[model samples]
Target: MLGAQQPASDQDRRQYQRVKVMLHGRLMLSDRTEHRCQVVDMSPGSAFFATDATAKTGERVIAYIDHIGRLEGTVARVRDDGFALELNTTPRKKAKLAAQLTWLANKHELDLPEDRRHERILPRNPSGILSLEDGRQYRCRIIDLSVSGAAVEINVRPALGTQVTLGNMRGQVVRHFEDGIAIEFAVIQRRETLQQYLS
Candidate 1:
């Protein structure tokens, strides 16, 4: 019995590791129409999003999940509320996804920061353009960077919940300060995504 255990295959891991989550983001159909969706459950191999929009089984989908970045797959099964996604990924990508899920699941259990899994750091290039959905743009200096949000020093203060884009990242104004505003990103962003613009 002691010698029977071995490293599990990806398929085996996928079957056992489905995680329940409430990640908000958007999904695009094969025709390129985007719809707002919420990921209710996920695993490296598959995920399910709760949304009114539905697609036929086998239809290709591209979803941008909050905190998880872009995922491409085909519709596996349709439920009344939503559909399951069968992730198309390489071994490396699957491993990366598994790690992210583990972190999200364990962060709270480990008594880590509840607001964000990662710590905020000063950006390499602090200057950035803050743009509103209404076509207004303002100059801003990045105060700090975290995967979930950023604090920027700007001249204008947008009301809480005002949607804005910092450089290329979409976020919402969550708080106001005398010097600037706090922006929570629409999705949990990869450090690379932050550096692409911040650097």
Candidate 2:
């Protein structure tokens, strides 16, 4: 998708494929105040989010999204329920956002569960970041890793089914232990992302 000042034509806008996505996140306005939001739809250069928080059109915003990291943008349209964010990120970040949108579009197209036995292996590098959907972050250790899920050693126990990001893989709390919690990846990750992010 092309990224610049603005789409030159309707065809250019059409070329910027819009994907229906539902990612939980939070955004900070120019005042640096945060509000809970869910990204409802996204394109290469913009995103729409559902939030009770009101923002004026043309206001600058910075958002921390699940799975997809941080995005900087400005409010393009304000709706009764939410607002559209016109992204001002670099071209590379926009390209990354496009790829993430593609993945979200095909999210239900699951691959056959890899490692049917769900073997857990100790990661060579145990350091990882645990992030909640609301954007709270904590340092965590990868106690064990597998293609489908992970046992992370962190201080807090998010309620079961709470969506979270472990390393760069999106998952949810499946179980909780005394010292940490168990996470099941939202999608069975490809070997490349699994290794590249975790190992």
Candidate 3:
């Protein structure tokens, strides 16, 4: 079951308010064991995650959340169904997390669709080279692109998480579709300059 949408307590609000969310990701334990988990709620300081993997309080955990990237923490508490983590990060990273949480909260409040983070458009040229980390390159067709990522049609499907270069852009293999794979850019691209590579 998902977390309830309840108002935050005064203390929670005063500290860092927790926002209800559903994000899928992998959790790595101190022993290097990995388990699939869903983040039920998150704040800048900590997050509540639901997973089948057993973990003790004070266990080190590293979660690689989609969109949010990696977050390291120690298990603060254990629940019947899941556990909570006390996040450990630098101030700059904490600020970034706060901003991301705010955006997610506002998007949910506005009932906005979550699938598209950036506006995707079909490139004018529709062609680019996909290069693997091992120095292999393949001719691929650009299906669509946005500032955040791109969908390309290629003959080969590299393993998920493989680092690759598409033209001049560096990104990782994020998803695989029947016809192609999706690449999420390491750094968000500038909308004004993105078309230059596409064209």
Report clashes for each candidate as comma-separated counts.
Answer: 1, 0, 0
Clashing pairs in 2: none
Candidates in order, TM-scores: namely: 0.57, 0.57, 0.56
**Candidate 1 local accuracy as lDDT?**
0.79
Kindly provide the TM-score of model 3 when superposed on the true structure, using C-alpha atoms: 0.56
lDDT of 1 by residue, 170-196 (tens): 877766778998887877688888775
lDDT for each residue of candidate 2 in 29-128, tens digit (9 for 90 to 100): 8987899888878888778989998899989888887667788777888999999887776657767778877765664344321224666778788888
Worst 10 residues of 1 by lDDT: 1-10
After superposition, candidate 3 runs with Cα above 4 Å error: 1-13, 115-117, 122-199
In model 3, what are the clashing residue pairs, if there are any?
Answer: none
Q: Encode model 3's per-residue lDDT on 1-199: one tens digit a residue.
A: 2443222234543688889876667899999999978787999888998999899998989999866899888888899889998887666776788899998788557744333768888888888999997899999998988887889999999986677888888776767889999887766778876777556
lDDT of 1 at 148: 79
Badly placed stretches (over 4 Å) of model 1 are 1-16, 108-184, 187-199
Best to worst by lDDT, what's the order?
Answer: 3, 1, 2
User: How high is the lDDT of residue 186 in model 1?
Assistant: 77
